[model samples]
Structures are given as structure tokens and as C-alpha cells.
Target: MTTARTLAVPAPAPDAAVKYFGAELGFEVDPDDLVRDLEAGRTDGYAVVETRAPEAFARARIPGAINLPYRDLTPESTAHLDKTLVYVCYCESTQCNAATKGALKLAELGFQVKRLSGGITAWIAAGYPTEGDKAPGIRCAC
Candidate 1:
């Protein structure tokens, strides 16, 4: 009687599921939502941050993203950034952890941050336009 969908593993209680998903939303942003906000010019409260190296950023990146490689994240380096803005951090794709690292670093530095779910790969896959020479199909060499 046990099918794969109804195996020993069960779903969380509805309340737990709600809390978990709500918390997840607090820490992540969908590519489509971000693009929609960008198109509507509703980006006043946040900043898109590309966490790749300078070369990778130059290759291709979200149109208005500021490059801030995760490795270089430090208080002094991030001092000029506005503390009031939420930094949406992302890198190549799900294959890269730079976004998570960058988000954590920014948080540690007393900044608000969120990870761009699926990173640049998802953004491009969603048909959003990027800015750079290798846009639209830039693969992660990292």
C-alpha cells in the first residue's frame, strides 16, 4: 500500500510548514520576483550584489548588481554600503555557494541580506536580461 509519495517520510504539520516556508521566504528571493521589481523600478529598498570574482562579474551579471566578491567581504570593505538596504546576493547558480557566503558575511557585518534563489542561472533561465559580454548563456567556470 506504500507508494513512493506516501513513504515513511511524512510532510511536516501545516503550522510547521507555514513557519518554515515563511522563514525561507525571509532569506530568499525568486528570480522572477526580482525581475518584476526591477522592471517596475521598485528596487529602492534593496541592492543586488554579485558575489563572484571581478572577472566573472565582468563576464556577465544582473543588470544593476554591484560586484562584491564573497572572499573580500569585511567590515572595512563594506563600510561604504548603506546599512538600510537589503543586499540580494548571488553567484553562478545552485552549484556555487558564493551567494550564501556573501549573505552570511554581509549579515555578520550588520547588513540585511538575502540569497537570490538559484542565482544567475535561474535569472537567465527565466529569460531575464543581463549586462555584459557573456550574458544570456554565461556558464560558470568557477
Candidate 2:
């Protein structure tokens, strides 16, 4: 006689296009790799764009990121030069889609784009300081 047993296993999810740019306009980056690249300062081929507004941005942002605010990338604003610039967009929290939307908008305007893996929240979480807000805030990790 013989005994039979079954084992349970989990499968990895399929790639569902986490980071995307406009129709064939930019290169995309996964969260892990993007963090590595940014930390190494190998971002010469990339530019970080903040999708937040001017008022909100002044309170602090991703240090050197540019202010294009997703809504501003219209036909009028897309006239800027530097088509060869790679872009990464970010917003408030990692859960927010503003960064992704901003990246897509830039791509639609013929600019290369990528979305920040977790937005500004991730940056600050990583201990990278943001330049804004004069008040001192505490970081609490759950």
C-alpha cells in the first residue's frame, strides 16, 4: 500500500504594467531598479518631475525634481526642448496615481517618462530629505 499527499504553492503574479509612459514615448522602470539607479546618481539620462502644484511644491519636494504639474503638459507647455530627457514623476504618497498620470502625460508630449515607485513618501521613508516645510515632523513606522 502507498500513501498520497498534496502540497500547496503560490504563484507569482503576471506583470501588469505598473510603470507606463504614453504611446511609445518613454522608457519604464520597475520599483526596485529605480531606487538603485537614483541612489547611485546614475540618473544623468533621467529627470524627476513633480506632478504637484507650485504652492504645494514650495512646502518641499524631491529635492531636485522639476515642476511640470501633470495638468500643465498641454500643447502649450510641451513646446519645451530636450526631447531626449528621461523623466520620472512623483506625487504625495506611494499609493497615489498622480505620478503615473504625470509620467504618461509627459510621454504623450513626446518626452521620455517613468513613474516614481512610491512617490515622495518613499523618498522620505528612505531617509532622503525633502526641501520644504519649516516645521519639524516626526516619522512613525508601523
Candidate 3:
């Protein structure tokens, strides 16, 4: 009998799994959940941030997302953001890391932060609305 590689490591205990999954939920928000919140106008406690270049953001982005490129996330630039609201950061897609970088910067700066799971790719794939010069549902080249 051969042990499958998938079972090389046993799964965590149910209690530990619960804690692990629950903690992951706190760090990421699904695109569908975000759209539901936006559609319902329940976004007062959180702000969407696009962690891409200004040109990329202008080409296509979440309807209410503020462009704050990860490379430019600084105390001076982020001062205008509301500290009370959790900032949800996203980049081109799961293929990109700008969102993670931005989230880390925000957290280091003492602000609440979460990453938009799968980023804009998942958002468009879900048929969520976006505002930009490009048409909605258009895949980003990135």
C-alpha cells in the first residue's frame, strides 16, 4: 500500500483548523462579499485601496477604491486616509503582490488592513462592477 503524498502530513485537529481558518478570514475578504457590501452601501467602516500604478488604476479599478500604489505608501501620503476604517488593499490579481505589500505597510503604520482575496481578477470574474476607462470585466494585462 502506498501513502498518498496528499496525506504526507496529517490534517490539523478540528479545533486547530477552526482557529486557523477563522484567522485567515480576518486577513482576507472575498470579492463577492465586498461587492455585496458595496451594493448595500455598507462600506462606511472600510475603504478599498488599489495598490497599483496610477495609470493601471485609472484604466480599471474597484468603484470606490482609492489608488495608493504599494511603492508610494508613506506616512505623508496616507495621512489623509481615515484611521478608523479598515483599508482593504488589492492589486492586478492573484499574480501580483502589490496588495500584500500595501497591507503590510498599512499594518506597520498602525492601521487596520485586509487583502482583497484574488484581487481584481476575482472581482471581474465575479461580474462585479468597476469604474475606469476600460470596460468592466476586461482582464488586466498584468
Clashing pairs in 1: none
lDDT at position 100, candidate 3: 92
Over 1-142, each residue of candidate 1 has an lDDT whose tens digit, in order, gives 6569666688899999999999999999999899999999999999999998888888889999999999999989999999999999999999889999999999999999999999988888888998887835555534
- The TM-score, computed over Cα atoms with residue i paired to residue i, of candidate 1 is 0.93
Please give the ranking of all candidate structures by TM-score, highest first, separated by commas: 1, 3, 2
Task: Provide the global lDDT of candidate 1 against the true structure.
Answer: 0.91
Which has the higher lDDT value, candidate number 1 or candidate number 3?
1
List lDDT for all candidates, in order. 0.91, 0.66, 0.88
Q: Candidate 1: worst 10 consecutive residues by lDDT?
A: 133-142
| Model 1 residue 64 distance off true place after TM-score fit, in angstroms | 0.9
> Which pairs clash in the backbone of model 3?
none
- lDDT string, candidate 3, 1-142, tens digits: 9889999899999999999999999999999899999999998899999988888888889998999888887999889988999999998888788899999999998899999999988887788888899745434332
Regions more than 4 Å wrong, model 3: 135-142
Worst 10 residues of 3 by lDDT: 133-142
Candidate 2 lDDT over residue span 1-142, tens digit each:
5444432343334442333334223444444566677667877877777787766566667667778777677878868747887887777765566777777888788887777666667766776757777334322111
Error of 2 at 69 (Å): 0.7
Q: By summed lDDT, which 10 consecutive residues of candidate 2 come out lowest?
A: 133-142
